[model samples]
Target: MMLIPTEKRLDADTPPEKRGQMRDGVRLLTYWSDSGRIVHGGFFQLAHQLEAGDVLVFNNSRTIPAELKTVDGIRVRLSREVEDGTWDGLILGESSKKLEFMHGLKALVTGPGTEPPLVRLVFSCSSSRLLRELYRQGDVIRYEHVARSWPLQDYQTVYASIPGSVEMPSAGRAFTWRMLAHLQKHGIRLAFVTLHAGLSYYGDDKWPNPALHPEAFSIEDEQAAIINDAKANGGRVIAVGTTVVRALETASDGNTIIPQAGVTSLYLSRTSKLTAVDGLLTGFHEQEASHIDLLQTFAGEEGVKAIYKEAVAKRYLWHEFGDMNLLMRQERS
Candidate 1:
């Protein structure tokens, strides 16, 4: 759906910087797919909407400090891990300028990756050394919406432990220890899957070509068993973000999920039938984002347009540190 020019945008269009307290003050917009019913409330009430037996699958992959400023003044953001000594990186500020690295490290721009803006950078060091140097010098990637640099803690979830993703699994960012305790205390089971998210925003017109974009994902046997058990028992399996949906659906064998680890090229659209995810908890996406298409899969085209319109009208904050929307499937028992 096209965005109305008069409508307000996210931190990009509005004043740059996060508003209010972290996680505690986030708004939750719930949409019931069966009836097209919408409910608005604070995220603190998430437990009230989900049943006790429901399983909320989260992407536990943590955000890496991927944004780096080279000595030559070129800005580099590593998008994906190509091999032990290579990465798919995006270069900004200078295209023709040569990159300079320390400790005998060297990066050569091979060619474009999945997106036009992304270029492959073959490095000289091993993965371990590259990661150490990255953590030492790089900061979290930011967009035009954020006016200043925020720490990595601001981009991580309360339960994030695996460090790999180039960007935050933003939907889970709204969950804090307090909120997690509440959900656990109320008997809502929480499970985790890992999808090391790559650079999502490339300052390009659309997302990376779905057929060409391959993201690494891992779903453990234990997590898969929990999800399958939940479904067998008539409990809903709600994915915390589009990443989780991608991971789960990619690993699914018929209606049962197989514990596996690999690169997933699966892309969800309005016509794709979801076999694993029954509901979704995700941040409000920009109008042009391909993520809207995934949202359109759960909530119909009209339903998504309505929900997005309400979110904009409500003046909900947008982006990584923005409000969340929960789309619940009507088929849930």
Candidate 2:
């Protein structure tokens, strides 16, 4: 895996608050795994690249204001919700004293979390109220790469409805309602699944552990039926993001998708067989990130490196507020 060049990184770049107007402003890089062909175009041209009957699976889980600034100057990013009003969160800015939050919320540091900056937080309120006050007091988490603070609405997709994910399912953020209508006019079908994305790649420099963190997801019967019919009819099932791939693959029974609603700890790698997805549309990820491994499972390692190198040379951006990549096979699997 190669590191993203400093200049090509999407440093401080964020799309405008209005998304539908910028459909033509975003960039897209498409790769055909079977034929080794690459096509670059504007994001608005996405509908023209695919034929009718393609099923694009999207993650509908919305982003939550998971970042809370404690009165003690601690920055707490709530990652995963747990039982008994507890949450797995990351605490930045060290404070030897117990932290106090807004809306009468108190944070009792239970223990170390799964990774660095992560810590277990036991809130003073009940489970339900704890969740409600989170929205009342917290702001959307920000990264060092971003220049300024943005609202939670800026992190949401047009189709986002369910509120659960700590972070945005950002690959789907490039989509607009108008673009979706265009896709529908071209006979491209859409399906929605819910995968509450957990902790994101912060400053961690190491590859993600194979033991994935549990993330909640839900696939309705209609969604499963749509995906199954698409596969059975020789239509491609294109996952809108890696989260959808994880949820769909986790709910797959052999080659067929099953309606399921639960938490998943599935990790896709070179060794894993992808039975549910035939194509992937996702944001440009760091080369050393775990997502590149999933990309290797879809495309080959060498091919991924080549395309990434091309993207870097062409000045395509990396990270959440970045360009998009569409990896599809020329032939059906």
Candidate 3:
């Protein structure tokens, strides 16, 4: 496992807005797979890193206020909604067969979930009612590193329109409207896919396995056509986050992407071969997290290790509010 030095573990506790900085001001680390070259710059320089024919695929999943507190002060983080309308959630503290929340809402712990600390919860109200109550009583899910509570709006991307992700698909957080307009003006295409990201952590140092934590994703016909046409015409398909990569790879059939909507538990690692995506722009992940494994798929083990080492030495911040990394394959000859 790649180890992140303690000094390099600094958290970006404040959002860019709170720091009075533009969203695109975050630092970016770029890695070219073919040449093993790394470049460091601000996120606003992203347009200059790609050619006019390149397409950036973004995940439009919006963050929801997923952390709810029980009357007894137990924190419940909703993971995802199941087909039966019940939610799979993580109980932060000791849990029982039943949980009581404010506003007279209650939930029955149906059974154990797919993993520890995860339990199936059947709320006393309907899904829609539960969502409304969540907005009324729920707060944005914050990890221990976040210094204070921020508004739910702070966790959403400028282009986010669909509301489903429990946690923000945060890799796209640094993108600004101006940056997007500049990219489009420079002839770089942008496409969006919906991937309602699930909870990344399971409490108590436990993390969800990407292969087991199935997230729901949808690719529209037009989006698929854009990606395929880009690839067909020698344009690179750059995934904005691992969520977009997972969605595109899941929808792909031997290098061609077919539009569809479904749940994906696809896990990519060094051993995995990417069939659709040519590059990735993502946030720095924890050392042991599966996200590191996904990065290996693009840059290989040694290459990823080198990139991480450089990032740490540069004092780049870590986590959702942290700096960004862009890994791209070399252009076709």
Candidate 4:
């Protein structure tokens, strides 16, 4: 496992809003795979680094309030709703056969999930009532790195509309409406897909295997066409986050993307071959987090190691609310 040394690990304890900066005011680190070149700048300078015809594919999955507490104060984070109406969740503390919450609502632990610390929850209330309660009572799920709780709006991206993700597709968080408009005006193409991001970590330093935790995603016909056309015209398809990369790659048949909506348990790594995405824009991840493995698929193990080394040296923050990394392969001639 690739690990960031303890002394080099940096955390972003606060969001930009609390720091009195605009959403787009964070730092950006751009790396070119082909030339081994790196550039440092503010996120506001993003448009200047891209050329016309390059397509930026963003995940429009909005963040949902997924963290809830049982009557005894045990934390439960909803991962996703399965076809049978039961929800898969991660139990932060020890759990019993049933979990009780406010309003006399209770959920029975149906069985073990596909992974550790995950359990299938069947609530006593109806799906609609459970959803209502979740929205009314649940807080946005955050880790130890985040110092305090923030509103759900703070976790959502500016363009987010479809609400399903347990956590925010945070790589897109730095983008403001004005910046998106500027990209369009500068002739960069934009496309959107929906990938309800699942939990990245299970409690107690445990993590779910990306290949086992399925995330639902949708790529509409129009968006597929836009990406295909961009590639045909010699433009790069840049995924805004690792979630976007998984969704696009899941729908890809060779170099062509097929419009579809489904669940993907795709795990990308250095050995994985990417057929649809040429670039990635994402946040700095933890040392052993699966995201680091995904990054290796884009820049290789050595390349990603170099990028992380540089990022640490530059004192870049890590986590959902931290700095950004934009990795792109040299454009095909």
Candidate No. with top lDDT: 3
- Model 4, 1-333: lDDT tens digits are 565786677888788878888999999999888878889999989887788998999999888898889999998899987854478988887878889998887889989776777888888877667778878898999988887888888999999998889999999999999999999999899999999988888867788789889999999999999999999998889999999999999999987999999999998888889999999999888766577788888787778988998999999988888999999877343
- Tell me the lDDT of candidate 1: 0.83
Model 2 Cα lDDT, one tens digit per residue, 155-210: 88989999889889988988889889989999999999999888775455643453
lDDT agreement with native, every candidate: 0.83, 0.81, 0.89, 0.88
Rank by TM-score (best first) = 3, 4, 1, 2
The candidate scoring highest on TM-score is 3
- Among all windows of 10 consecutive residues in model 4, the one with the lowest summed lDDT is 1-10
Name model 1 segments beyond 4 Å from true.
10-22, 96-98, 102-104, 204-206, 331-333
Model 4 clashing residue pairs (backbone)? none
TM-score versus the correct structure, for each prediction: 0.94, 0.93, 0.97, 0.96
- Worst ten in a row by lDDT for model 3: 1-10
**Candidate 2 runs further than 4 Å off:** 7-12, 16-24, 115-117, 202-210, 331-333
Taking every candidate in turn, the Cα RMSD to the unseen true structure, in Å, is 2.3, 2.3, 1.3, 1.5
Error of 2 at 241 (Å): 0.8
Task: Show model 3 residue runs off by greater than 4 Å.
Answer: 331-333
For model 4, the superposed segments whose C-alpha errors exceed 4 Å read 331-333
Report the lDDT tens digits of candidate 3 across residue range 111-151: 97766667889999888888888899999998888979988
Please report how far candidate 1 places residue 131 from its true position, in Å: 0.9
Q: What tens digits encode model 1's per-residue C-alpha lDDT throughout 1-333?
A: 775443476543222135436565678999988888899999889998998888999999988898777677678989889788778888887656347765555687877766677888887788788888878888888877778878788888889988889999888988888888899899888899999999887785555766577899999989999999988898889999989999999998768999999999897889989888899999876665467788888998888888888888888778877788999878344
